[model samples]
Target: MPVSAAALAESLGRVPPSCGPVRLVAVDGHAGSGKSTFADWLARGEVPVVHLDDVATHDELFGWTRRLRATLLEPLARGADAEVPVYDWVARRFGPAVRVPCAPLVLIEGVGAGRAALRPYLARVLWMDVDQETAGAAGRLRDGPELDAFWARWTRAEREHFAADPTRPFAHATVSRRTGGYAITPGPRAVLDPDFSDTA
Candidate 1:
């Protein structure tokens, strides 16, 4: 692992586990706020990552909390391995179950990963600090014009989900991906009125 990644993994390892014997960390942000990429970098130490994309389907984008608990949390809570069902976006259904060992640390990366239901199980929550408009634009570009309709539907769902259950306010830290490493600061909850602006 790179120096920064190694340091990050070591830092996370120091935190007390919140879920069973595992430190369940969350990397959450807007759709295109780069949570996946950031989580990938943090996973250079072979940490297991459960991407929400594989857990959410078109009909249940933000309502998979129960499923998540059943598939992952419950098993992990018992100090056992889990088989997380991966949703197939192309087929609009669950494709296969991915085995996840009960590792010492695990990361949940996606929009709404730090929602209320999962907060209690998380050792730390890192919000990807990026504005909605900018992130949405990046999302649109990445998915391409063909998925414009999907993006439109998604933005609405995301907006509603955040309005009802905001995550940033409860985050332990806010991470911004910089040119080479990353800029991590105290989150909204850690610092009053934290200036998490991308320009900052």
Candidate 2:
């Protein structure tokens, strides 16, 4: 029983708003965990998605929590639109700010979206259940050897970051990549039944 993207979106729509008439959902996982693809599919419902990668820079990857809270969350929580900084990964710097319209449903997708500091504002947290080794390998392959050094450093930082403030314990659900789609299941803290679904 693979759950379709529409079904997942429907399920998300059922969640009560956690902040200012907005159901802020966070999709977190290791690098190269297929979060971007899944987020795009989820956003097909027209939900505005805020990519954490856009908020983080070479100097501050997992350290963009403060920036996110101040720039995006605070304003969104007040039902006000805010301008968010978009980082250019190629240039390793932040470019112009992009307007983040106040939406009823917002998806924040990234590696540390479920960090302890950001969880209180989230209505639901989805974890992509992919092993670090596999994710790292995929990332290396995708980014090529040019980023090997950066990946090495990122791996260490990610390990430390997760160790200090793990998100798995608080995740509402877990998503695993299947041949043609994904398998969704309730996390350890979830009380809901497993839901599988497909997405292109």
- For residues 1-200, could you state the per-residue lDDT of candidate 1 as single tens digits? 11377667778877888889999999999999999999999898499999999999899989999999999998998899999999989988888799988999899999999999999999989998898999999999998999999999999999999999999999988887777777777776652122332325
Off by over 4 Å in 2: 191-200
Error of 1 at 134 (Å): 0.3
Worst 10 residues of 1 by lDDT: 191-200
lDDT for position 16 in model 2: 86
Write the residue-wise lDDT of candidate 2 on 68-139 in tens digits: 998999999899987999999998878999887888788999999999899889988999889899989999
Tell how far residue 127 is off in model 1, in angstroms.
Answer: 0.2
TM-score of each: 0.93, 0.93
Q: Name the TM-score of candidate 2.
A: 0.93
